[model samples]
Each structure stands twice: as structure tokens, then as C-alpha cells.
Target: MVDVQGTVTDGFEPVRDAFAENFARRGERGAAVALYRDGRKVVDLWAGTKDADAPGDGPSAPWERGTAQIVRSATKGVAAAVPLLLHQRGLVDLDAPVGTYWPEFKAAGKERVLVRHLLAHRAGLPALDTPLTPAEAVDGVSGPRALAAQAPAWEPGTDHGYHAQTYSWLIGELVERITGRSAGRWIAEEIAGPLGLDLWIGLPESERHRPGRISDVEPPADPAAPGLRMRPRKAVTDAYDDPASLTRRAFAAISPAADENAPAWRAAELPASAGIATAEGLARFYASLIGDVDGHRRLFAPATLTLARTEESAGPDRVLIVNTRFGLGYMLHGPASPLLGPGSFGHPGRGGSLAFADPESGISFGYVTNGMQKNVTADPRAQALVRGVARALAG
Candidate 1:
């Protein structure tokens, strides 16, 4: 039996049970789950070995409270927050053309693309026609230049699609153009440092030893195939399976993908995909978004928070080929990735990691795993824990 450790408020023991059951039934490696309610930490639990294959017969290093994991696309939520916070501070206007801030974005007939279009995935700049090497991508050298020169896959704001890797460079460059600070640096100074969250877009060399090694798990059987809980529409499955589809191209924007666990990758700032954080860190960050955490500070005002969560796009996604919904910069609760309630908003990583805040329930949740299950939107393990959270709240 795996030994799960941490505290849960009196009524939330079910969350701990679900966390352990993930190890027994869902094959979880090192992982953690945390929750905050009304700005107070309610549940914080972690279990399993940090280095599952640690050398000899000696005991493996346990997953520690400080251990962080690379949360692939879940980083999108954090990155999105940077710009939204700036918008709240009157630094950027959502309705203004992105070219207003970054003049070069006016190239390729993209002069009218609004800042909100980028946040809501309606800019239609999903895949780059020119592929970038992993090294050039990590060094922040090629992605922005290539994207600015390429035309959109569809008319900007006419359709919505997941930008995948392109989102990092697009938003990061926007932040840099406006603030004269890289998104990572601005986040460190304004968000993470103020909140004291152990999250990083561009991790420092000194923190290199903190992240656990990530390993991929076999993907779940196709949902469109027989014996699945939910069958996808033909268009959804077709787009994902075709190598030449926009869906595939967007995800593969970085050709010969960079090694995610490498020191170089961690040290670079890929705002959309390469964020590092512990489950607690993610939960606390979300908690701050919805309300105050530890009397430290709240990131969004009520008006700005409302705008951030308002649905900007809802329909078939050109790249994902599924009916998806998005807010200003976060994934809304929907068929693609459901969180606590209709009011819940957040992003899920390409793998199993997920973090969200439910304004209705005053719940902020985060879950991270070193063992990655290949579910694009919802991972079953995280879903199970979410169910446990629902049950606890209901009781």
C-alpha cells in the first residue's frame, strides 16, 4: 500500500483516499493533490517514490513537499494570468490590436488580430508553416520571428483553435514588448514573488534539483472505439489521428521535440508548456486568483476576474476538432475538460496534471503527476480525484 501523507480538513478524507487509489488502480508514480477552500488550505497530500527507478536495492527517494513537476500545457493558465493581470493594472487593453503592442505582428495580414483573440484562441495562429528546432525554440530565437511572418491558418477571430506551442512565444513576446521584461521575469517579480508560490516559467539553475523525472504512460484506448465511456464525434477523432491535420500540426509545431526533462528545457521560458510547480503551488496560485490566500494578496479584482472567466469562444475548434470552450486565457468547464462547476476555470496539461478554481464552491484544486497518462484534455486519474472532491463537498 502506498503511504499518502498530508492534511485534509475533517470532511475531505475522500480526497486522500482517491489519491492513494490512483496508485493502487491507476498506476500513479510520484504525485500530489491539493485543495484550498475560501482561501484556506484544506487538503494537501503527496505519495509514491520521487525516483521510481532509483539505482540499487536501496530505498527510493520519497516524493517531498518541495518536489515540483513539469506541468506541460497547464502552464498556459499561469502564463495567461500575467497578461490579464497587466490588463487589470491598465497596462494593456484586450480590445486593442496585438499589433498595437508588437508592431511586427502587423505583418502577414494580421494587423487586426486583437489581444483578446490571442487569449481566447481565436487568433487562428495555431501552427507555424516553418518548423523550429528544439534548440532555437528553447533559446527563444525562432518561434516569434516565424509566427509573425506566417499567415493565420484561418481568418483571425473567425474561428478558434488551440495554439499549442505557438501560444508561448506569441504571449511571451507580447509581454516582453509591453513591459520590457520577459514573461518569466515579470511573473517572478509580480506574481510568484508576491504570492510565494513555488512555480516557474523559466526555472533558475539553483532550482534544477527540485523537479522530478517525468515518464510517459500508455495512452488510454480511443474514446471513439467500442467499450469507451464516451465516444467522440467522427470529426474529432479524424482530426487527431491525421498527421497532416491542423490538430496534429499545431501540437508538433516544435519539430524533433525538445527533451522536456533536460536542464536546458527547464532553464528556458516556454510559457505555454514548460511550467514547473508542485501541486500545492498550483492550488495556491489558483486560490489567489479567486480570492485571498493566507491574507497575502489576491491577483484579480472582481471585475477583472469576471472578464477573465467570461466565455469568449464556444464551438468546434479548428485545431482540436472538438467542441471546446475558452475564456480570456483559461479553459472553461466543458466537455473537453470539466472542473468543479460551470464557474470553474483553469487549464489542464497535455499529460495528467490539472489545476482549477471554482468560484461557485470557493474551491481551488491542483493535481500533478510525474507519471504522465496521455490524455489530451482530461486524465482519468485527475477526474477521479475531482469526483472525490465533488463527493466531499456534497456530503
Candidate 2:
């Protein structure tokens, strides 16, 4: 195992093995994992090189360091949290019609859609029917405005489908309409700011140098490669492998740009997919749900937290093609869930980054890696760390 350094108040040493195995698998690239319990920082560790160009930093390079890479869809969970928090304060209503807040959304038979449907990934605007470039996707006003005009793929709440890339803009517009501030600013001023979390819905240019430079993983040369064909049509072909296609458009920070680490990309703030955060900040955010950090509580009420962990949709997600279940704003432990445990509720980004909370056990975990893996969830490397954390927590 690559050298690791961190404290485990509960004395779970296996957590070290989790990091070791993944680093070994990645040839010693840089990554970080953090855990919080009862609102206190319990596990904060880092290792390897942050960038491939400047390797050989050794184990002492600083586990507590590194910038947020695009956590992909993990941003959805963070993005979902904004509306939920607002709902709690009567600033927004979960059961009320989404168009009630964002009138423009009513244009496409979305008048009956509720806020919960959007959070649950059932709003049905998965891929924008209108093709947009990376620049158009994140050019501030254009992305959300275009989404507001798009039509739903399925009936609002009839079936669940992962919104894929469109979720943030769809929900972001509602957030802006309701709070009068873009989701990014609101998250920064309300959630990240108060909690002292380094997470960002939109990244700022000043911190660009801090982020670990993410190199997109090259897809399998042969479609027959193991794991390459898992869901080749949807996950591979439709999402990442095409040149100048939707997947490329999806990655470009310009046309509905969801580029995980760009400055203009970070500034747009599509909570569903573009969240940037370090493992430390992510863990602390989750820890706040079960326990408060320095007297700060930035999530649902403890009871509401309990409510969120309860499964909402647990079957074939029309979009993801897996039996994914969702909690209020998090992913519930289900057959398709990576961590595969009852108490956990969180989401994994498209390329392997993840963050979640296990409220029943008062455990919060975060994993961030620069190396992008093709698998969306149940990633062996990420699961190893989670399993280690679980073993540590239980011990």
C-alpha cells in the first residue's frame, strides 16, 4: 500500500488498506479520503502525486492538500441539497409545482411537475433535445434558459431516469427563480460558506491552480474489453466516447459545459453535475447531517435527515438503466448502489468521485481522485476505501 497518514478515532486500520489498494491500482497517482463522525474530523488522508507531469512527490506530499476535481454526478446530491434546505425553511416547497417558482419551466407540459420529482431524477429532461456546445452549456444564463424551454422525455413522475447532464440546469433555474440568486452563489453564501467547506457549485478562477489536473481516462480500444461494454450504448457511446458529439459537448465547458475543473466552468454552477470539492469538505458536509461541526448544521434536520435516507425510487432508473434508488437528495443503499449498505446515502460522480453520509452509524466519507475511471458506480477502488471506512467505523 502507498504510504498513508491519518487519524481514526475509532481505530479502524483497514482504512489504510483501502487507500493502499487504490493507489497501487492507479500506479501511485494522487487522491484523498476524509471521514467525519459526530461532527468531528476523524479521518483525513492524502498520498501520491497530484499531477502525472510532476510525479515522485512521495508519501509525505500532504494528504490534507489538493483541489476539487469534477465529482461528476456527485454534484447532483450537493445540488439537490440546496432545494431541500430551502424547502425546509418554507423558501421553497418540495410538493409544490416547480413552475410555481420558475414560470418558464411551465412551457413544456412541466406544469404539474413537483420539486421532489426533479430531485428524484424523474423530471425527464435527461439530455437536452437542443444540442448545445460546451460554451453554451455554461455561459451563465444560456444553460438554464435553454433547459427551461426543453421538453420532458417521460411523463413528469411516471418513471425515473437519470437526468444525466441536464439535471443541474433544470434544477438550477428553479433555485435561481426561487432564491433570486444562482445556485452557485447560493451554495457558496449559504452552504459552503457557513460550513467552512471547500466545495463549490461553481469554481472560482483564483483557485484554479489548486485543483488536481484531471486527465480523462482513455476508453477501451476494443468494445469487447472487460467493463468497457457494461452499458456501452448509454454510458460509453452516448456519454463519453464520441468525438465532437454529445459526449464531447457534455465534457466541453462551453456548450452546456460541465467541465469539472475550469474557471468559467466552475463559475456557472450546475449543482447536479459540476460540483468541485475536496474529500475533507465533502466529509464535513455529510458529517453535519448526523452531527454538527463547530456548532454549524447545514443540512436537513436530524429527523429530516432520517427521512432523506429512506428510499424514494428503487428500481430501474429509465436513464441510468440500473436499479438506482434515491433519497431526498442522496442515493440510497440499493442493489445498484456502490457502498451497498442500509445506512449510507450519497452519490458518486460519473468518473468515480464520491461523497456520502451514513447517518445511522454517524459516519461521513468522501473520496476524490484525479484519475477518471469509466465505471459510474460500484467502482472497485472507491468501494475499497468505503469498505475500509466501514470496517474502521464498526471496529
Candidate 3:
């Protein structure tokens, strides 16, 4: 068995057991899970190897308490706060047209796209006609420029779809235009730094050789792992398989996929995808969103917190083809997303990373894994840990 490490308050032993079961029965390789309740750490655990750089049946490096990894689309939740924070400070108007901030955005049909529309995934600019090459995608200017030139797939705010790769440029460009700084730098200085968080929007060069330098994990070796597997959905599979489908096109907006472990990709701030964080850092971030952290002030005021969980858009997502719920950039608890509770809000990475906060329960949770799986929103490994939290709360 892969030995689990870290501590949990007395009531959280169920979470430790769940973390162990993930490796023993759920096909979890290298993974970590953490949670904060009422602003204090309640669960922190890690298990298995940091196989991001290691490969094959070779001896593996042990996963450490401070290890971090790219959290894929989960980055959206972290990046979402940037614009909202700006709005909180009266620097950006949520209802105003995005063109009000970035004039060139008005050149295309996007003139009608409002700030809230972008947050709600209703800007209707999911798939790109001309996708960016991996190099161009991370070049900073190329992404936002490409998105600015494209016409919307639907009328802005009339419908909703997961922006997928386009979201990086959409949110990142707005941050740059507003702060005159890169999204990564802004997040580091404003959000992560103040909170003393081990989170990074774009991983830095100096951090590469640091004690917990992150790398990409290998894909699942067994799709039919006994503990959990995908519920067969022909429609979901068909949509993704078809090149002409919006689902496929939206995900393909980055064209040739970038190697996530590549330093270049890590150094460039793709706010939608390139976030790197340890389990605790991510959970602590969510804790501060819903309440104070260790007596420190929270990032979201009550009004802002309400804005984050308010239903901005909910229904069949045009790109995902699955019924989804969104509040600004945060994904709400729903059928497709099994977060903590009805009041929960956060985003999940494409494969195994997940994080969220439930103000009603005073719970902020995060889980990250090197065991990339076919599961998207509610990875079984993550849900297991979440259920453990529920058990702890019950007692």
C-alpha cells in the first residue's frame, strides 16, 4: 500500500482512511487532499509517488506534503477571483461591455459582450476558427489577440458554453489591460502572496528546482479500475470524438496541445489552465474566499461571496453538452459537479484535481493527483475524500 502522510484533527480520521483507499483500491497513484473548516486546517494528506518526472515500473519518488502539480481547468476558479476582486474595488464594472476596458475587443461581434457575460461563460466565443500553435498560445499576446478577432458562436449573454482554452485569453487579457501587469504576477502579489499561499498562476523559473517543483503525471493505466469508472454516455463520447463538434473544437482552441510540464507553459500565465498549487494552498485559498483564514481577512466580502455562488448560468452547456451550473467563473454544486453542498462553489480540473468551498458548512476542500483519469468534474477519488468530510461534519 502507498503510505499516506499528514495530519487531521480527531474527527477527520475518515478522510485519512478515504485517502488511503484511493491508492489501495481506486487506482490513485500520486495524490494529495486537504480541507479547512471554519478557517482552520482539519485534513491534510498525501500518498504515492511524484511520478511527474519518473516513469515505468521503476522505483518512484515519494509524494511529499509540499508537492504541487498543475491543476488544469481548476485554475479557472483561482483566476476568476481576479476580475471580481477588481470589481469589488470599483475598478471594473461587471455590467459594462468588455470593450469598455479593452477597446480592440469591440472590433468583432464581441462589442456586446459584458464583463458578467465573460464570467458566466456566456460570451459565446468558445471555439476558435484559427487555433493557436502551442508556441503562440503561450506567447501572451497571441492568445488574447486571436480571441479578439473571432466572432461569437452565439449572441453574447443569450446562451452559455464552456470557453475551454479561450477562457485563458479572455480572462488573462482583461487582467493585463486593467492592471498593466501579467495575470500571473498580479495573482502572486495580490492573492497568493498576501495569503502566504504556495499557489502560482504561472510557475516561476526559480521555483523549478525548488523542493517541490511540479511535473505532469502519466495518464490512467486502467480505464476499468474496480473502485470507479466513467458512467457510459454515448452522447458525451460522440460529441468529443467528432472534430466538427463544438465540444471538440472548444477544447482544440489551443491547437497543438502544450506539454503541461514544459517550463515554457508553466512560465506563461494561461489563467484558465496553468495554475500550480499544493493541496493545502488551494484549500486555504477557498477557505479565505468563504471566511477568514487563521484570523486573516478574507478575500471575498459577503456581497462578493454571494456574487460568486449566485446562479449566473445553469443548463445544458453548449461545449460540454452536459448540464452544468456556473456562478461567474466558479462551478456550483450540481449533477455534473459533485461539490460539497448546494452552497458550494469552485472549479474542477479536466482530470483529477478539484477544489471548492461550502459556506453553509464552513468547509473549504481541495484535492490534487498525479493520477490523471478519464473522469472530469467529479473524479471518484476526489468525491471519496469529500464524502469523508461529510462524515466528519456529521459526527
Candidate 4:
């Protein structure tokens, strides 16, 4: 067995072993996983190489494991929570028309759209009508400019679609408009700092060395196959091109998906994407939600956590083109969910990154990896680790 170099709290040994099994079975090059239950961490383990192409590197060395890794779309759950937190503080309202916050959003018949609609992935604007460069997408001004100028794919609030790259800009702008601080800064100061976790929306320059170099995603043999959950047409033009392509143009500079270890990418405050953290930090972030964390709660009220866990949308997604159930700011557990049972709520990244809070059983599980996989949502290997945590909780 490839020994991982992290600590596991007592009573969650099964979860530790289960993660080990998945790491070995899948030939995981680099990965980190952490779980918390009842306001306490239960499972924390990581192993393997930073890049799949360099697997001969021993997993036994503590220095071999990566740190401050990117978690991809999992950043959305954390980002969306910012507005919800503001709402609870009486600074913003979720039911109010979104245009009330950003006047330009009134263009394109989006005047009636509510803030909840954005949280639900029903605001449309899934695809840009015109091709946008990654620079345009992340340039503080360009993202909102394009969103305000573009037309919605469908009527807002009438249909659900995975916003893909647009979600971060949508919510991040709102947080900035409301709080006068970038979503990344707010999250760093309000959420991560208060919780004493190392998670980052935009990474810090000093933390760059901690992350493993990102490896290229394996390309599918056939793009037309039904096995594809996010089709080519469904993705932005910059998503992927040519076989064995390592980088997506979508993250050219300031986008959340920026280079695995670039200084600018780490410094920019993109709330919807580009979060960097350790599994321990992510688990600590969620652990605060499960209960009082040393008597300090980042969220304004406890009931807000309930709102986050409750279902908001479930049906065919306009962008993903599949049924997706979502809570206020997180992905709820469902038949198609990667997490085990309905009590789990978290987000999964396009590659192999995952984070969840199983409040019913008081469990939080997080996994971060450098290896990029073809599957977007249905990676059984991630779910298997979640299931193992569930069994440990039950036992």
C-alpha cells in the first residue's frame, strides 16, 4: 500500500483505508482528502504524485504531497455562500430582482430575475453569444460587461443550466457591488480567516509552492459518445482542443481556472472559481457549518445552513443537459449525486476535486487532486470514498 502522509481522527479509520483503496485502484497521481463530523475532523489523508506523468515519485514522503491545490467548480459553492451570508446579515435580499443590485443586468429581459435565480443556476447566460477570451472573462470589467451585453439562452428562472464559467462572475460581482470588497477578499477575511482555515478564493503569492503542478486532462476517444456528460457544444470554445491538451484557454490569466501555480492566478479574487486550499482547510470550513466551531460561527444564523441544505432546483439543466438538484449554494445529494445519501451537500470539480458536508451524520468530506479526469460529474471513484465515509459514520 502507498502510505499517505496525513492524520486521521480516531473512529474514521475505515474512511482513511477507503481513500487509500481508491487512490491505489485509480492510479491517482496526487490527491488529498479530509472529512469532519459533528464539528470535528474524522478522516484526513493524502498520497501519490503531484502529476500523473510523474508517478514513479514516491507517495511516502510528506514533502511529496501537494498543497494549496485548485478545487475548480467546487469554488462556486463557497462563492455563492457569500451573497447568502450578506442576505442573512440584512445587507442584500435574495428575493429582490437582481437588477436592483446591478442595473445593467436589466438588459436582455433579465429585469425580473431574482437573486435566488442566480443561485439556482436558472439565470441563463450559460454560453456567451460571442466568443470571449479568458482575459475578457476575468478582466474585472469584461466579465460583467459581456454578461450584461449577452442574451440569455433561455428565459431566466424558467430553466436550469450549468453556468460553467459565468457563475463566478455573476455572484462575485454581486458580492463586490454589495460589500465593496472582492469575493475573494471577503471569503479570505470573513470565512477562511475567522475559521482559521487556509482556503483561498484567489491564492496568495507565497502559497504557490504548496500546490502541485496541474497535469493535463485525459481526452475522450469519442466526443459524440453518450458517455459525455458535458458535450463539446455544451462547453465554451476555449474548454478543450486537440488530444492531450493540458491547458484550457478559459483560464488564460485571471480566470478562476488559472495556471495551477501562477502568481496572478493565485492573487485575483474570483469567487465563482479558482479557490485554493488544503483538504484540512476545506474540512474546517465545513465543520464550522455543522456546529459551533470553538464558539465562532462565520455564517450569521444557524437556520441559513438549513436553507443551504434544502433543495432549490432539480430537473434538466440547460447547460449540462441533465437533471441536477441544488441546494441554496451547494449541490444536494441525489440519485445522480456523487456524495452518499440526501444529507450530503457539497460541490465536485471537473477533474477529481470534491468537498461536502454531511450534516445529518455530522460528517464533512473533501478531496483535492492534480490528476484531471474526463468525466465531469459521474466519477464513481469519488463517490466510493464518500460511501466509505458513510459506512464509518453509520458504524
Candidate 5:
């Protein structure tokens, strides 16, 4: 049995069991799960080794409470909050054309793309025609510049698709253009700083040692293999198998993908993919979105929260090739990836990290892992934990 540590409140012990089962049965390398109810943390648990495959050790370092991991696209939820907070404060108009703030966005028949369109992934600029090198992606200016000059793959506001990597630059540039502050800086000063969370969009050199090194898990040898954890839907499989498909292009927009475990990638701000945080920190951040946490101010007012959670787009995502649902900037609960409940809103990382807030139950959850599975949506381990949470709430 994995030596799991930490505590869960009286009613939340089941969540700890589910977390332990992940290491015992689901091949979890290193991971942590945290949950908050109302304003208080109810469950905080972590287990396994930081690097299961590291050399010269009987086992890798113990997974400590302070250890964090890079939560790929799960970073989108935190990044989204920046613009949404600005909107709540009356600094941004969601319905306004993006050109109102970033004039360069007016080119390439994108003049009609509204701020909401960008948030909803309906702006039709999911991928860049010109691919960006890892260095260019890290530089910040090059990726957004390429996006500004390229035409949308589809008509603006006509259809929705997962922006994948482009969502970072699109939203990041918008935040900078409107507030004259980088999204990372704004998030640090306005959100993490106030809540006292360890989350970081642009990690500092001083804290580089805290994150666990990431390693990819191999997929099942046969695509048709039964009971495969990372099985893709038929539509998803068909789209991904085609090299020229929008789904493939959108995910590969950042060519020569940056080494996620590298110091440079962790220090640079890639709001969609490179957020580094402890599961507790991510849980606290989401908890604050729905209600005050430990006397810290709530991030979103009720009306703004409603707007952010409302379903803005739902249908076949042109890029993901799955029926994905998106709110203003969050991935909502759906058949594709049911997080906590119907009222839950959050984003999942490309591999295994998942986080969300369920206002109906007054619960917020965060899970991060260093052992990444090939699954794109809900990893089986996370799904098990959510099921445990549901069972706990039901009781």
C-alpha cells in the first residue's frame, strides 16, 4: 500500500481512500488531491514518489505536502479568472470587439471577434498558420504576433473549437493590452498574493526545486485494446489520426513543443499549460472563487460568477472533435468529463491534473500528478476521486 499522508475531515475520509487506491491500482507515480467545503479545507491527501523512474535510489523522494507539479491546460482556469475579474471590476466589456483593446486583432476578418468569443473558444483562431518554436513561445511576443496576422480557420463566432495552446496567447495578450500588466503579474498581485496560495503562472527561480519532474506514460499497445484507460472516442480517434485535421493542428500550434520540465518553461508564462501549484493551492484558489476562504476575500461576485459559469458554447468542438462544453473560459461539467456535478466549472490538464469548483455543493477540488497518462479529458484516477466526493456528499 502507498503511504498516503495528510488528513480529511470526518465526512471526507472516503476521498482519502480513493486517493490511496489511485497509487495502489491506477499506477499513480506522485499526486495530491485537495478539497474545500464552504470556506474550509475538508480533505488534503498526497502519496507515491516524486519520480518513480529516477535513477540511483531504492525509491524516489517522498511526495511532500509542499511539492507541486505543472498542471498543463488546467492552468487555463486560473488564467481565465484574470480577465473575468477585470470584467467584474468594470475594466473590460465582454461583448465588446477584442479590437477595442488590441487593435491588431482587427486584421484577418477577425474584427467581429468579441471578448466573449475568445473566452468561449468561438473566435475561430484556434491555431496559428505559422508554427512557433519553443523559444518563440517562451518569448511571449512572437506567438501573439503570429496569431494577429493570421486569418481565422472558420468565420468568427460561427463555430467553436478548443484553442489549445493559442488560448494562452489570445487571452494573455488581451489582459496585457487592457491592463498594461502581464497576466502572470496580475494574477500574482491580485489573486495568489491575496489568497496566499502557492500557485504560480510564471514560477520564480527560487522555487524551482519544489515541482516534481514530469514523465510520460505509454499508451496501450493496441488502439482497439479493451479497458484501455486513455481510449479516445471514435470521432476523436478519427480526427487525431489525420495529420491535417484541425484537431491535430490546434494541439500542435506550438511547434517544437517546449520541454515542460525545463527551468525556462516553468519560469516563462504559458498561462494555458505551465501553471505550477500544489493541489492544496489550486483547491484554495477555486474555493475563493465561490466563497471566502480563511477570511480572504472571495474573488468573483455572485452575478459575475454566474456569467462565468453560464454555458456559452456547447456542441461538437471543431478542433477537439468531441462534444465539448465551455463557459466564458472554463470547461463545464459534461458527459465528456463530469467533474463534481452539473454546477461545477473548471479545467483539466492535458494529462491527469484536474481542478474545479462546485457552487451547489460549496465544494472545490484540485488534483495534480507527475505521472501523466495519455488521456486527454478525464483520467480514471481523477474520475474515481470525483465519484468518491459525490458519494460523500450524497451521504
Candidate 6:
């Protein structure tokens, strides 16, 4: 407990303790967690170092209020909202074929893929037959062009896989094709700006230099950090190591994975990943998804909210090699990525970040950390804080 800062409404002291325990017992380098109940923020706490990459444990900036970090795949939840919002406004049709918007997607036997199928991870186009280099991925045209011409691994909409990296183009191109604007610009003007959230899909240069900004993520200093999951390790490792495994190909769609800390990756908008936000912004964004935030109206209407949390896919995930559940773009509370019980829908960044909203309990939560971990989902530190929130509610 290196002096956790920020308020945690009287009942939420447990959550603050949980945040502290992450640093003390879980090898956390720097992190923040926030919570909103109904429409009000009940917790906002941060601790540990801000410059996680600073050499040799030398003196570095303290993690302070307004610290933000890239939430990796958690960007899916935010990106999912873009299409959903468009549908809500009658600009996009979920049931229609994605080719209705992006004609190029009609090639390679994918003309039948529905818009909802993309969101539900059932487009059957998870891995690229030919992978892109890191530079080619952010080059704007290569990713989408490769996906449009490549046939689905499985018949379109016949099965589901995590989509992994290909999801960037699946959704990004669709958004751009329909809105006549970059997905990043649409998000900023439509969702982030109106909601007054400090979230960004494409981070700007000014945010890069700010004090306490989560510009980079770093590995845990400790040798024995928590790993990918609680399981017999060999099986998972084999799946990841197999050259032809969906797990391998899907994750490696962009070989070597782009340097997420680099300025170029931050500037390019990749909807399936590469979104950044503070714990407060992440929590508040999800809070607004399910209900109003502060005085602003909620992003999703009641019917749209129902559609979002409704389970669209479940069972052994093709890429993850685990039982996972999804509701459109958001991950549902499930065996693989349990959140706060049923109806909790959100996404977790493979690195250390988690955010979700439980419409059933009227709770929205976020945890952002510079200490990247191997755990893809249900990260122990985040799970501990989620438990604390559940405890606070019970108390």
C-alpha cells in the first residue's frame, strides 16, 4: 500500500484496499481503478509509479489523478458502441449484410456476412491467410484490403472465433464506409466529445507529453507475476505454439504485434485495439452505456442496452481455447472472463486493463494499469477490485 489516493465513498473503502493489495501482493507497478453506481462515481483510486519504464527503479513520477493508459482489446467495447449507436440512430442496420455498407467486403465469399456477425465474432474471418507487418497494419489500406479479398477461414457466419487482430479492419472499414469519416473522428465527435470523456481511439500528441498520462505500459518488475490463466499450462501453451492453430494465426495477424508504446501506433486508429482512457473515463464510458453519466443522457436506450448484453455467442472460443461468452462486441460475464455476475458486459485488454457495466446491479467498473500481465481475462488484480465492489454492495 504505497499511499493510494482519491476517494472511495464510505462503503467502497474495500475497493481502495483491493487496489492497494494489487501493488503490495500482486506485483502491480502502477494502476488505477474507478467505479460508478447508478449515475454517480463511488470510487476513484490510483497508486504506484507513473513512469513504469523508467530505468533501474530510479525515482519516477508518481501515478496521479487523470493518468490514462491504452486499454488494448477493451477498445472493442468502445468500438462496438459506434455501430450500435449508428443503428440506434437508424444510420446502420445490424441485420443487413456488412457488404451493404462496404462493397469490397462482398468479395471472397463474404457477401453474406451480416453486420451483427462481425460484432458477435462470427464473421469467420479471424486470422489472415497472409499476415501484415507492423507498419503495414497501421498503413490504413493494407489491413482492410487483405481482409476484403481473403476468404473466411470458415463459412461466413457459420462459426465464431475471437477475430483477434482482423477485427480492426472488420469494424473499422465498416464504420468508415458508412459514416464517410474516420472511425476515430466519428468516435470523438459522437461519443467521447458529447460524453465529455477523456477517452480516445487515436491519441493525440499533446496527451502523449502530459504528466501522469499512461503513454506506455511496462512488464512487472517481479519475476513471478500471475500468468495467462488458472489451468493446466501445457495445453494452452501447445495451442499458442502450434503454427497452424487459430490462436497463433489470429493473434499474429500483425506479426510481432505493433509497438503499442510507439507514437505511430497511438496516432493510428485501430478499433479492435489501441484505445486509451483513464480509469475514470473507462468506467464513465461504460456507465453511460447502461445509464446516464453525471447529468448527460445514457448512450444506449433501454432496448439497445438489452441488445448489447444479450448473449450472441458462447462455448469454446476458437482462438482463445477456452469457454467464452460474447454479446455482440462486449464480453459477457462467463467462465472464461467472469465479471460481476450475470449481465455484466465489457471487454478486457490482454494487458492489464478491464472495464464493464453490470446493468443488473447498476454498477460500472474500470481498472487500468501500466503493469502489463499475461492474463488475458479475469486479471487477478482487477478481479480483486471487482470482488471488493461486490462486497461493498453486499455490505
> Which model scores highest in lDDT?
3
Instruction: Please identify model 5 stretches exceeding 4 Å from their true place.
Output: 56-58, 209-232
Q: Least accurate stretch of 10 residues (summed lDDT) in model 2?
A: 216-225
Which regions of candidate 4 are displaced past 4 Å? 55-66, 209-261, 298-300
- Local accuracy of candidate 6 as per-residue lDDT tens digits, 247-275: 88888888766777788887878998788
Evaluated at residue 224, the lDDT of candidate 6 is: 20
- Tens digits of per-residue lDDT for model 2 on 1-395? 56675655558567777787788774446677888877878778877655433445553233346445567778887787778778778788788888888887788788888888888877866666566776777666776777678777678888876666777677788888888888888888988888888888877766665434332222212111123333444654443455444334333323433334446665667677667788888888888766778887546886667657777677766645556888777888765566637888998876567888877677888887766665655656777888887777667
> After superposition on all CA atoms, how large is the RMSD of candidate 2?
4.2
Off by over 4 Å in 6: 219-232
lDDT: the better of candidates 3 and 6: 3
Candidate 2 vs. true structure, TM-score:
0.85
Which parts of model 3 are misplaced by more than 4 Å?
A: 219-232
Q: Model-by-model lDDT, in order?
A: 0.85, 0.69, 0.86, 0.69, 0.85, 0.85
RMSD of 5: 2.8
Q: Give the TM-scores of the predictions, in the order they appear.
A: 0.94, 0.85, 0.95, 0.86, 0.94, 0.95
Estimate the overall C-alpha local distance difference test score of candidate 4: 0.69
Q: Judging by TM-score, tell me the better candidate of 1 and 5.
A: 5
Q: Which 10-residue span in candidate 5 carries the lowest summed lDDT?
A: 218-227
> What TM-score would candidate 6 get against the native?
0.95
Error of 5 at 71 (Å): 0.3
Q: Positional deviation of 42 in candidate 4, in angstroms? A: 1.6
Model 6 steric clash pairs:
none
Candidate 1 residue lDDT tens string, 1-395: 99998889999998998999999999888889999999999999999877644568688778877678888889999999988999999999999999999888899899999999999999989998877888988777688888789898889998899998999999999999999999988988988888888889998777876344332222222223111123455666777678788887888788877777677887889999899888988999999998988877688899878977899999887876667799998999987787889999999987689999998899999998877765778788899999999999999
Better of 2 and 5 by lDDT: 5
